[model samples]
Target: MAPPLTPADLTPALLRGALEAERTERGGLLPHRLPAWARAQNTDGQLTMAESQPSGVRLAFRTRATVVELDTLPTKRAYVGVPPRPDGVYDLVVDGRLLAQGSVPGGHVVTVDMTKGTFAHTPGAPGTLRFDGLDGTVKDVEIWLPHNETTELVGLRADAPVEPLPDGGRPVWLHHGSSISHGSDAASPTAIWPALAASAAGVELLNLGFGGGALLDPFTARTLRDTPADLVSVKIGINLVNLDLMRLRAFGPAVHGFLDTIREGHPETPLLVVSPILCPIHERTPGPGAPDFSSLADGQLKFAALGDPAERAYGKLTLEVIREELARVVAQRAAGDPRLHLLDGRELYGAADYAELPLPDELHPDAAAHRRIGERFAERVFGPGGAFADR
Candidate 1:
């Protein structure tokens, strides 16, 4: 067996899906979903945190190594009174198939107090994750990072030298949305809905899903515009309603402006605009959704809509309202942009599916729902005769 490689051995070329690999002060590489220029424009801590989590990020290379090891520092978030979140998972995929899943033993923790809007960081040491007994033949390998944790790549070691895998010439599917798309409740990074859908459709994935951060931000739109993609999709509305960020007066123009930015770079690419899924709490009621503190006391976290349903009379946004506006916007623009399409998010998870696989948090879907959504999305968007189907 060869000696372990140093941190310098893991170059940016081996990374896939991340926009940037910012070298940390500790000499580790921290992946960022947004490029440096766009990250500079970030103000909200939530957006900053979400983008740094590396939802679809992975290290892709080819090697005949029978054994491999990786050192990483992961920052896991914990609510003050709520049960601690599980350690972030690392998935090992060999030649496009999932082979193993594991987690680093020790890492940093950030305890958050939702009620006080405060947090405390407890620094911890890096831990090494190991995988062994692989097929002896040279093959493609992917180490999928934790979708829900901020991870820093410290070092990598393998029996054989690794080389970056050449592009497989697959269509790149770029998708942006909220936590559901970010793999919040999904079991693993590769199991995320977008990843699942991309896998099913034989497309490369570049996910821009940011938990609580998909509120039609200009920087996000600009990032989407600058990125190269054969297919593009944006899941809108849920974040806007949950944050109570804007009213109807602002939403229409924001939606248009966001689409306009994307079209600047991808004028003819198939772009799908998706409305929010069936979030019963905010379907008729306006948000700023609030946490159900009562659940936390019961040792589980849940969310609830705090706004009144009647507030829509004054143009406050709800899931219902946002869906209508998004459909209207897409319909209005489709004449001039035939490639643009709209998909009602509910079609992926509607009243019937909700009854069977209900959202455990009343906001984010569970792993089963994610699988269901991914399967439905693949059939609807990437299936034959679908919007993104081959021409």
Candidate 2:
């Protein structure tokens, strides 16, 4: 049996990972992946939403606590016209095994009415998660917060002492990408493709994957340039296609500039540029992606591409177009930059694979799909002779 709850305070020196935590005036702590200095550059709602999601951020420490209690306020997103999205998932891992899993319903809720293309926000009540029946022997513990929510940690209390995980000289992999990389539809925070791949590669992860926010922003490029990193990757093309943000003329220069900024930090770092994975909806079609509620009445929801295929003649972007361009860009730059390489996202999850494990939302991969992508990435990116192979 687990030890009874104590009336004592339990403190775990918070492990920030790649996050920057700010103490709330209300005795809570809000974790942000982007540093305050970077955040001050733009007030874009997409950036704000993505950075606050904490897709790859978690709290880790060593503890002997048999019963752990954590209090937090989570800002879960909801769609007004559609059914409620699943509560963001939190996972409890002990000694590197999943010990428990739960979801918090309280905190704040952000409502998005896709039908009207509008949004609303409301405060949420505080909720607590309790994990008991641990072995009680001193062991490592990791609490992975919801990858798709904005959480304000109100308090952390346990039955014993807690301290940060000691660094073991792991390789640090820094990555940046769009919503798919941000853990959309992932079963849990750590199950995200990047996290899974990182574990397999034996690398410390610094995920800059932001939902709807990887538009090749200069500030993001600057952030990557400033941050210390051994290996780096930029998963480009998808967000730019979906958002219809730039034309081929501007796209080439923008990519060059993004990489130029990062090179300022680590000139010899093995840098990989990844194009978007195959999205059938935008394969031949251009986009300003839209929610497809056609299946909603039948209790399903998906996304559809809205831009016309002929728009390509006017410099509109599509998956195929982006893939071809990314290849050419890397090939041309490779002669002058041996450290630079390209990976077609389609190679990760292509037409054949999609035939077996299709994207559930027709945009984002489901949990099962996430596993497939992660495993493939580990084998392709971290395996011998891969883009990230040690020199």
Candidate 3:
């Protein structure tokens, strides 16, 4: 009789879609979207937390294992007085198709008090995810991590031997944007707009969509400049305006500098600069956006732009103002760099979209909107004659 198979030894090479894989002190593997140097340059807790959440990270291998198991430690987020958030999902993809979904039950929780601007952490036991009835044929397998949770990979077991999947030599598409691009409200990791777009366009995706952290930091720009990519894009303007991070004087120069830095590494790469989509709350109103506490008290979460509409005269940014600036920047740069291109954010989602599929939270798009955006992006950006199209 044949002996039973054992757990396959795991290493960082087994991971794809992440920039770095750090060995955790607890003998686990932690995937980081940003490298250590980039992370070390920031002190913001929110950015720290957002980048640690592996939105597009996944394990890719080729195996004939009929049953596969993964042990993980996931860090979940909670809000004081609010209902507990749903457990993060684990998506199983077999040979490029989503086959099943699972979840880890316990690990850790970071509870935040929005009213007090405070947070605390509670540790819990790790959980295991099991996938059964996979075909015995040796085929590609991908375990997509949760997009909204910070996860540490502990162990991997299968009934048969496994090895890292060979690269398919597809072009890499590196994209950077705000939480909307971070898969906010998407049903699963693969459902995120960028992922969907990449799948449709037949490319590999490297997503740098950090929630509340897309403020165009120098380190982030540097990271983008340094990363290897066959195609590159930066979705700008939303986070900048919503955060009220800078005034018009700083906005232009900062954007110019960011693009300059990226050009340092990819001078002739086809680069697309996308503006923010139509967000009614911030369409005309400047922001320093704030959460609607009244809605929160009713156990619902919503956002409101706190800045006045008239603030545009003072150079306070509204989405409208941002779109104009982004257009101008791309137009000016494209004159010198023919590879540079711009896509008006409204082209993806505009007033007509708002009338049909309104942003439920007054900010982020819902699952359906994500699909719409993803499909449109694939058709407009990756199709023939599109900016990033294969010429």
lDDT of 3 by residue, 181-274 (tens): 9999898899999999999999999999999998889999999999999899999988888898998888988899999999999998889999
Prediction RMSDs, each to the true structure: 1.3, 2.0, 1.2
lDDT of 2 by residue, 103-189 (tens): 877788888877877889887698988887788798988888888998888877777877786775888888999998998988999
The order of the candidates by lDDT, greatest first, is 1, 3, 2
The lDDT per prediction is 0.93, 0.84, 0.91
State the displacement of the C-alpha of residue 181, model 3, in Å, after optimal TM-score superposition: 0.6
- Assess candidate 3 and give its lDDT: 0.91
TM-score of candidate 3 to 2 decimals: 0.98
Q: Indicate the TM-score of model 1.
A: 0.98
- Those runs of model 2 whose alpha carbons end farther than 4 Å from true positions after fitting are 1-13
Error of 1 at 215 (Å): 0.6
Backbone clashes in each candidate structure, one number apiece? 0, 1, 0
- How far residue 153's Cα lies from its native spot in candidate 2, in Å, is 0.9
Highest-scoring model, lDDT: 1
Residue 116, model 2: Cα distance from true site in angstroms: 1.7
